[model samples]
Target chain A: MLRLPPFQYHRPSQVEEAVELLDRYPGDAMPVAGGTDLIPNMKHRLFTPGHLVALKGISHLHGIRVQGEELTIGACASLTSVAQSREVRTHFPALAEAAGQVAGPQLRNAGTLGGNLCLDTRCTYYNQTEFWRRALGYCLKKDGTVCHVTRVGRKCVAAHSADTPPVLMTLGAQVELVGPSGSRVLPVREFFVADGVWNSRREPDEIVTRVRVPLQPKAFHGSEASGEVSTRVRTGYAKLRQRGAIDFPLLTVAVAVALAPDGTVTWVRGVVTGLGARPRELTGWEEIAVGEPLTPEVVEALAERAGQQCRPLENMIQDPGWRGAMVPVYVRRALGKAVKQGGGGSL
Target chain B: MAPTHRIVRLTVNGDTRTAGVPVHYTLLETLRYAMGLTGSKQGCDKGDCGACTVLLNGEPRLSCITPVWEAEGLDVVTVEGLAGPDGALHPLQDEFDLHGAAQCGFCTPGILCSAAGLLARNPRPTREEIREALSGNLCRCTGYTKIYEAVEAAAARLGSGDAERERGERKEGVS
Candidate 1:
């Protein structure tokens, strides 16, 4: 039986008290919401914090609220709740789909959005028991000096495999964090760093308070000229994983597009994740789609351009070449589905 | 000497229960070791496996990852609590037995709890919904075909009982 290392647990009833506890312990403690990710990692000896500030008691840090054109989801809201919420399903169906498909239903019922957004980077070599890791002489992520993924690499090459971050990036979301000093918000896209060793920019003392999802701009309601240019807005999210039952995504493609009244693509933005440590927003999509209807040739050209940005190293189970090949195929499929909806896709 | 654990109060299966658990002791460990309710299996201590599934306030949750303190004051329903006052099996249990859903029986309890919760919320779930609801509960024994049939049968029995109760109440109102 794999057992977690003993640690002192502290329960705080409010978010303020939770941050205060973090302030007290600073480097010694970590805040745990659902522990779906943390406990498993703890058992593997990846994280052995001396103190864990339990965030379950903080009532304010739970629930989803929608006001006018904005959606605010508390950090402690469980993935199941987000997936099952009627409003989220209506306005942000992509988020709901991503949340529902994360792992399995049991994990979704306990895993929180804050935890999912801040999920630890994953790798086959680094996600093993201490004894197993010791036999392998460890890797850059844990008690070793060399990165097993690429022996010649100087830093860890673990992959960021979270499902929601990529979808959130497509929705243009922002994350709100609070610490002993104050609070700050960062764009969801900027929160991730390309370096595998330092996957995120979250400070040690900061606790993610909420994730703010701005309202999708209604196409025809804005300025007359821009409205004429953008007659509709739509988005689609597709994931490639080894198993349909539940597993971390092997690759993910999220695309959002705006179309003119005649169905000519006015603007397009796409991001690809699970290919590397950071999600790269595919460039040249706007140039290819704008002023041109979503013709098959343009879609194929955009997909090929997007595939050029992925650096699929042999860090996962599938062959890197095959995984890289699927990048364009999945991107084209996702965009084809998004355009097929006639701008009725999940925005 | 190891330090003492904290006392966490819970309402399990309509009864008040208490246990002394370390801060790190998940609800699965507390129920099995401290409270003596071992029906919920601990297949994958991680939330990936649904063997430790139970109802927290009528919703199925992964108890293996949930801390004992987080479940305080919630109505926790386990497989052991599924029988009636006279020790008769719930309709779901009877259906499972009729359909031969369990080969090894380790995954049955968790599946039962999850199916019960699903019936409580959505009595007439479609086949797809049933499959989606039980997707989290992994059973390598029966290949899941028999399990789905069993849950569908149980839902019918439960639905009939609910209709009968409502009819009885309507007759009383008329009188």
Candidate 2:
């Protein structure tokens, strides 16, 4: 019986008009693309915007377009479309898999790609109803000062619960932001912040318009235009959760690797999310993986190194210790699967 | 003063109608309260529960979280609309009844809409596809074994015909 607080709603037929409305309302309004996540959060009293600018009405803000070597996906494109898109599945299966894995069918149909990327950081303490949060004395994420995760820390440590950002981070995607001043494109990695309070760096008056990802090579062999190449860029994703469906990941791993024709890992990027305020690209993998072929030993060693760098606090479902301990295992399996593209995951 | 409300028009069960709804009223509230399409249940007001599922332009979407204003110019189909003009049961509904797929029947409406969405796109879905399609719709009863069987049986009966194809009779002809 939780109902949304009353708010003035505006529907703009164009992205420009939407940006103008956002600029007009600034601090008093919030843009809603699909309302999949925001509506629930609003019901929980997480955000109480006096005005809501609906983004789904904009016709231009809804499709997948290929411009040269890049693929631009509108912010309002539904996750179901993104998941089922043959173009996305063909060039970037990880994005499709991540989109498909979000919640379930009904949600996927309503949730949008931009909303998923800009999903609010979720925490057991912060996501509760206002009455529940009130009883707990409120946390830094909302009305209070102290953080429940790290009692001494002043910042919110709510986990970044979005699935697409981690995979998009690994894919090196860029997000396009439109505001009253103008529009600018930034790397997806730069779009997120380490603090949960202002999880995404998107300014209050700015709305994310689309995400542009340079199309990746179909294989590790060479140019995408050079068709019929047998080699392919190996990619894989692994998410550990409590259920087979409808549960957010305790830990998510996405890995992409391009092999040297000889089978040595040439270029590799790995990211692990759902652990902290932001999805982090694991460093030090190149130190061990660059020249060496991905044997079991190399993959295992790299996974251990990557796991050491991840700073997972006590957050999300289940015990934090168990969740933190799973980082390396999932990473190892993800990389192993990436090494064997056509083959099933190792483990 | 009374809150400002919009005169919203929506196409429900192939009929276009208008209603004065507050901007904040979700499609669920409008459907259950104003239009009286109570078949779409209100399990979880959030998108977590699929009880408020309905077809927005033939795609299953969470009506609870969807604003009533967004349904303007969109085709909406509810479980009540699943029956034929002569009131014949949808194959999926008949199968659900045959296999006792519904226990308490709280989650059946949403599950049915989600299954209809799946059968529309993919005629003969595998067991895994059926499970994936129903992932958003949660059922506390039946452990999903009976529901899966029911969807499978419905798909068998609906082979190659339009998933939206209603049985019995249709003057305008069914999809």
For candidate 1, the docking band is: acceptable
lDDT of 2 by residue, A169-221 (tens): 77778999998889898888888898998888898888888998866544222
What's candidate 1's DockQ score? 0.47
TM-score of each: 0.92, 0.92
Write down the RMSD of all candidates, one decimal each. Answer: 5.1, 4.7
A125-193: candidate 1 lDDT, tens digit per residue: 887889999999988888899888888898777888887788778767889998888889998889999
- Model 2 TM-score on chain A: 0.93
lDDT of 1 by residue, B48-131 (tens): 768999999888888887767778878999998887766777878877877788999999999999999899999999899999
Best by lDDT: 2
Question: Which segments of model 2 are wrong by more than 4 Å?
Answer: A216-232, A342-347, B1-3, B160-175
| Chain A alone, TM-score per model | 0.93, 0.93
- List the global CA lDDT of all models: 0.81, 0.84
- Please give the fraction of native interface contacts (Cα pairs under 8 Å between A and B) kept by each candidate: 0.59, 0.79
DockQ of 2: 0.59
